[model samples]
Target: MGRIKPQTLLLQSKKKKGPTRISGTTILTCNLVVGLIVLSLVATYRQWSNRSRSQAEDGLQNLEDTDAVKDLKKFDLPSYAILNTSKGFVFVELHKEASPEIVDKFLDLCQKGYFKGMSFHRVIKNYVIQGGDDIQGLGAAEDWIMKGKPHSELAVSPKHEAFMLGTSKAKGGSKEFDLFITTAPILDLSDKLIVFGRVIKGQDVVQEIEEVDTDEHYRPKSTIGIINITLKQEI
Candidate 1:
């Protein structure tokens, strides 16, 4: 047997397998990176899912609103609106037969509680008391201008008389949202306005509203809000 040199034995003993040994810290760091990537993917998926669900809900709401408007337009039964104002309650008898579209618009607004907390923006002594200005942070966003809106432009209709509830007489012609109660007969309006209801009760309340202090622009100085408007179907 040949005897090996000490140096040769030492070199053979020092030779490694040529593979890098993994430390616990390195393994833990790799695992944490993989876990972070997984968590990020999960979070993104959930966010996208939530956004899709919200979009679907909004689309459904729009479709239902369209159906509701259709139902309101075809309404024929006599209805009444009891407007609970800041000062007092005012009763109005809706003339559905005379102005079906206009009356239905009013009814739709009432049903949606759109008039709650609305202020009387315009007040004219012995002229009219107006409310439903989009000023209460309510307006165009309400889908007010639908695809098939009839009589979008302002034009006059018959039956403008005292105590009548109808559209505004000026610019932004009410769009079925802005409304006024006539204190006296106003026939000088060349622009078309609607008269959908007649004041059946609370004439004094109407008078008080009309007589309230107003700025030069006819806007009420103090808040005269419509607490709420309730509608009832007449048999």
Candidate 2:
């Protein structure tokens, strides 16, 4: 409680000044760091959104440029045929223009040997010999493959008729490789098969498959596997 010496006073001043400068610098550094983090987050979000939008636009553009839609209005249906082993052989005229994305995906899968050695798990005589579905079998013969999404939607046309392979209902058909044939009378199906192509020459093969012994659900008793599918132009 006596008077302060000069040396003590000098030391006290030095301690106070050092701490004040350090505190100011630390506060400024923290503020700068917080601002930089917020800016980085904002940049990342904007980049992600822009990339998604760009991809969607590109997809739409591709559909617009395809030949299927351009020729559909001309009343000329594009054709395709398949040589299947179990079903013998089959031919189909495609609804190419109407469902370009879906049809292209189907055609691509067939060409890439995806349907080789795959069994027609759902073969219905009167309804459809639905195949290209491999979800059930687990044996060594099982070969599971995935096809990309398709873009085909059902449409009500004045020329609507049964037996015509139409596009799938709602937003096209499933991404899987499943296909259905028309066995219904007068083509009064509530849903349309995406008619990428029509059967032109292989109705006999379809008939042979129909003759096979089938379950109550129309699934064949013995496995009728598709050995390979070959596509070609019509004569």
Highest lDDT: which candidate?
1
Every candidate's lDDT: 0.72, 0.58
lDDT of 1 by residue, 114-205 (tens): 88898988776766676775333222222221321233332344454678888643434355478778776656431345678889999999
**RMSD, one per candidate, in order:** 15.6, 17.7
Task: Report the backbone clash tally of model 1.
Answer: 2
User: Model 2, residue 39: what's the lDDT?
Assistant: 97
The superposed Cα distance between candidate 2 and the true structure at residue 35, in angstroms, equals 62
Q: Which parts of model 1 are misplaced by more than 4 Å? A: 1-78, 134-158, 168-176
**Compared with the true structure, what per-residue lDDT tens digits does model 2 show for residues 55-84?**
999987887677775665333422474657
RMSD over all Cα atoms, model 1: 15.6
Q: What would you estimate as the lDDT of candidate 2?
A: 0.58
Roughly what TM-score does model 2 have, to 2 decimal places?
0.49
